[model samples]
Target: MLLPVVALLAASCKKMFDVKPEQVVDQTQMYRNVNDADAAILGLYGKLMNLAKQHVVLNELRADLMDVTDNANDALKQVTLNNVASNNTYADPRAYYQVILNCNDVIKNFQIMVANKKFTRDEFNQRYGDVVALRSWVYLQAGIQYGTVPYVTSALETIDDVKDESKFPRLSLDKLIDTLIKVTDSIPYKDVYVTGSSLVTTIDGYNTGKFFINKKCLLGDLYLWRSAFTKSDIDARLAAGYYKQVMETGGNGDYDTYRIKWSEVTTNNDIAVGYWNDGRVNQYSENMLVDDNDYGWRSIFARGQDALYNTEWIWMLYFNASFSPENPFIDLFSNRGGSYLVKPSQAAIDGWDAQVQSDNNFPYDARKRLTYKTLDGQPVIMKYLYNYVDETTYLPTSLLNKPGKWFLYRAAQLHLHYAEAANRDGRHKIAYALVNNGLSYNFDNSPGAGTKRDVTNTQQTFDPETAYQFDARYGDNPTFRAPWHRNVGIRGRAHLKALPVNGADSTTLIENMIVDESGLELAYEGSRWADLLRIAIRRNEPAFVADKVYNKLVKDGNGSAAATRARLLAKDWFLPFKWE
Candidate 1:
């Protein structure tokens, strides 16, 4: 792509009219000095942190997983019910566009920094890589929520540039992702090692190691999302390619991994007397630290918690409470009467309770307690928070607590993505292993196979014949023969298995399982609504979306469910690009 000469950059006096190409600030001025270079890049991250709350609203709240409280204002309720009006607060685009502007600024200016000898070539690639990743993050949100949005790459600088919002045309999610793949491709990466995998040794340290994304993470993520929108095996295989790269980056097949205590895996055997048979009110011992314990969650991953040095986050935005508006998690999920807008839906609560009740041996899912904080009258989500307290003091839990960090990507998310991609490509054996390998539960198999038989029938194990390493790209591995509902069929605490889904009857079966897993694991962290949209579009299954997202799930008043089902019938997965 060539840029026009200065002579042809604008309209001519006695010629056909043409608009001058808008230039934001002089990229040269922003990136020339080391100080400005640092500030500009840091600013990009700061801008991203600010958009975190809105990101949740657009990504998680719009999905069927939540319901609006009666206390919600009309604007919030409208979005909660998908009664999106042109002027609805949830329909605002600027919240994301502002982040795009910061990304463009960092991108266009970084080159000047390199030219001015402010950063070495290697370092230049690293900083520019961060900017590109941030851009991809925003692009992903907008692509999913808006379907197509003004794809602005360059910053809007001058007065004319600011005024001329129409200069950039809205592009499809496919086109945006194409750009994302290319952006991650350009970053300089190195092979490095961090913990969590002891297998395949070499990994690209594209933007440092595990915390900031390397090329493999970007490629894996980009292609996985891409697979949702395309019917081609090309995208599926491409996703596998990147996911394989991530796996191999670990070397020696995922050694040195972190996992929860085995005793906590399946049902607590002694708890035949637990709440429900069941434990009483959140009584897990303080010493019972799980991988997702808030202690480490805040210590290692919270914003300003020595973030740059901590690993495994892949990409995250750390927030500072000193800003004009502190971290927004409180206002977003506030339990203060009349203040909070969103709460967990009856569907989520009912589904979770049902999942636990169906298996009487199990007391509860640890994730359930961690995710939703059920108040006396109304329940609300708590995944984004535990208590807003200064980490060291834990005492003064402030209602306006501000230390919130967005966990955008992590090893667990990748693992789930790998399993789904493999399953979709018809590689059930490997999919089963990938899911089971790091499965968080340990089975209490002492109950005898009769009581332990998840299906309780002697129909034979789904894949009783063979064993092989998990590799989904090629189907040469051993087979997984678990029944459709799995129903704790696998020989473990959390009986997650490679579902019997290699044939035509199981396509929806497999898809539904993956969607269910994603919702359970990544609840309220963003990506839920995108999952709904992707599945609806990919399978051309509007009824599924309507049934799950609108009707079967929520308790509707105001005919919101019926109205939303009608829109899904129209194949509408997004609010109109323009409010109109």
Candidate 2:
């Protein structure tokens, strides 16, 4: 008897928040034609849209600016609360499993198609390879976020379809790493041709782009996952081996390749696999950007014309308006007369200044520009804000359109991975070099340009030779200098310094540096919480604590003060797990 495909694939909803699949395709029909199989694959991509949306919430809430402790006393005040449970609720494991089911369907149907002589060997292999890679990608997200997830290689249709959910406990870190490695090995390294109407086609012709998995990016992701899961198990040999693979595959031996891959505006050789959201046509952008005046929560309040942008955001799901009208980041950063939805925190600004300055010994080195702003004929560096805007007019078609793709995996992060691995494996020199090299990419030694006051120009002038002198004069006191003048002057002091050649626990120091760099480099890439968890686990940090005191501050009659105070309570910060 033929098993019903719906029985095999329909997911059992456990929570009210679970999104019911709007449409379901029968497995029998799924493999009968190329379009059927292609549609199944498209479903996998559709599931990825959830990842893009989740990323925005995760990045904004976890960044230094948002207070994780706050919960609105009433529905009105809760709008901006950074409650972990609320965020975690949005990242439901079942939602991820739904995506996995789509991938499983693709893999299963592709196998069936090949067996039935419906697909050639080349077609089967290529399609099978894509499915395997996509499945691995989904598992990586699940494994990293919710450790020891149920590994389902087949689609689940009915309640009985879920084979031994209780029996499938969390896999060990070593096992998880092995699984990812094997998955990566299965994908073909060579390029594959894709011909189809562009999802964002402005005209009628199909817009085709060559697609293939870069061994380096895949391996880099593997290493990152490995590092995340098995920090203690990481040794020098393994670290060097993986890093060498990344460097060799990267072609550009320089570390810049890893860093630049994070740019949404540029898509070249570095990316392994990721989605692009052009505002003009992407559905996700439409949901986020289009004025929802007729229905839902957005319809009640002033419809947010701009989405969300945080200078702290390192890697984002980008939306290109030329491709789609719903690009969210465009509205978020473009100052089209909208209320600035996101603002850099004072702490983040201070951190940016610190990152740009030179160390006392290394006077010539430049620092990373974490954020940027224009003020008083000088550019004030804001650590989180990367894009520049000229006007703040609220119009759908404003010139403030800044379109850049979101980076899933960046080169700078890989360097940090190398540094961490080196530190873990007792390669202090290598770790230091990797960290410094990554920081060097953002340094600028050129004199100030644009409407510069004489004093501003003098202070903004970045001379490698005099970097030490500048650090000494302005390093301790950042406030003394004008905001614009201070931007370049502090580069020497702010940039991460190289590790000491000898220390009691050089490895630990390297580890700390890696953690610090992770915080500095990936401040707003939906990584802070993960980083915090990793550090807590590695360092055995006692239950999280809140450093800020809310009572000392005054609040307007609005519940902002109480909300802020409640947010400051460390105990209430973490997500309350249903099981916990």
Candidate 3:
């Protein structure tokens, strides 16, 4: 799979941000400069953007939280029915392989750039590690959907080269996870690239730094998969450690930059709704004032890339309409000016409706209003409908003209995944607290606990591990309050009450809660099917996934629920890898 003519990079550097951006030119002349390398990386991301709709469909449609609408095409309907045809357009692996091919080209050529003294060792390490992580992420997505894929890392001229069975053996999901962990673990630079590096740029007024793949998040995810596949405490602990690295204070001197403070959420119309720090925003619909309180949580998705958003978003990609590949989500999720093909299932709405706030006994999660909304007589996903500017206002059908975002990694995911790992590692109390309430609320509340937020909880007590502890200390004294002291667990940030852990299998119960919380907090964005599949495989219970999908199908009035469940119980968790 050696490089050939390299037609993908013939365009000038200025055209690199186009939808069909180039990856490389002639190998002998390419990677001769850092600018060349930067263009290649940007091009790789452009290719990654093409997979946004496919990624969401592959990850969520097959799972429980999302359902295809009547307007959906045959391929999408096939996905929801768990009867994807071999020729189904959505089942095609070429889009994923297109990304992997670009990542491979970048990784291979960047090494040559470093060797030729065209790039510094540090520069090469950071970019090289990023491309590697991006590739790993793509492979993880591929493995999750297809089960067995040709894990090709070498650069090649055409995607067809991987068809050679002897040279590129198809690896199963478990083996792919192992290879990703080993390869990603070996990278020297595990953190984000140094801030303000040449690789960081501004495109359409948004900083491109968040566009890059996060290395630590990728490693944590890899280890999490491995931990599930092997049921090893060591792997779980390793996964927790990596997630902690992302959640801890960033090096930019911003205290609690990546943390969701316990005080951020509110049941009443006060301060902020969730992670959004922008002052009280007036939410509007159809040029009329609807509600002011609903804007905060929505800001997490609707706001532009800035210090306020960087706190929660670890990695994100934006699609400009002026660019070649417009935001695909506008067509998939928006009911205005676009085809609303897929939507949040009734199961997802019910999941959010079941939540009750701890402090005020709020009937439903505050996030429910922000996630999806009723428009044109039907509920549609709201997260991707508006651009940063008009999230609070319905200013025409902007979905056709405004830019849309694709969330790859964020703070909630870091905490949720860490809690999953910690629970598996025998830290169930900490994990349970992290999901329902913050560490301070569930653990640090005890005798002589200074803050009113802290409470004495003897029933769920556990010795605090230094790695997972978040100090409950409060008050005006900065001397006493540690950085993570402001940290709030995932459900806590949604103002939800803590779930009691009374069962003998506390770990399993808490783990299941974590999985459920993932569905509630992260629905429609992706990761639903993968989360269910991983847990089902780990527990060696096919019904774990089958039951959820079956429930969702039945709730959505799909007659194929029973048949799909039967297929799932037969160990059919992945799409058919027809390329093989």
User: What CA root-mean-square deviation does each model show from the true structure?
Assistant: 10.8, 14.3, 4.4
lDDT of 2 by residue, 1-580 (tens): 1212122222221111112344444445456655454445444543554565345444434334332222212221232343434334544555566566767766776777888988677667666676676667667665645556666776556423443657455564447657877776656632233344221111112121211233444454566555544564443335445554543332333322232222122321112111234545443222222122222211111111122111111222333333222334433333333323343334444444454223223222122222323433333322222322321222344455543344454444555666565566555544554564322222223322322222322333243322111210111122323222221111121233433446454776666666655654555444554555444444444232122213212211224544544664433433332221
Cα lDDT tens digits for candidate 3, 188-270 = 88877666777666656777777888888888889999988899999998898888778774732445567765543333222
Runs off by more than 4 Å, candidate 1: 1-30, 33-35, 158-166, 190-215, 247-312, 336-338, 356-360, 389-396, 436-505, 556-558
lDDT-based ranking, best first? 3, 1, 2
CA lDDT, every prediction?
Answer: 0.53, 0.41, 0.75
Deviating ranges (above 4 Å) for candidate 2 = 1-43, 63-83, 86-91, 120-123, 158-240, 250-343, 356-404, 438-505, 542-580
TM-score: the better of candidates 1 and 3: 3
Residue 493 Cα positional deviation in candidate 2, in Å, after optimal superposition: 15
- For candidate 1, lDDT tens digit of each residue in 374-413? 5656576665554354333332365544555566765446
Best by lDDT: 3
lDDT, residue 15, candidate 3 = 42
- Pairs of colliding residues, candidate 3: none
Off by over 4 Å in 3: 1-16, 19-29, 251-255, 264-295, 388-400, 445-466, 475-479, 503-505
Lowest summed lDDT across 10 adjacent residues in model 3 is found at: 284-293
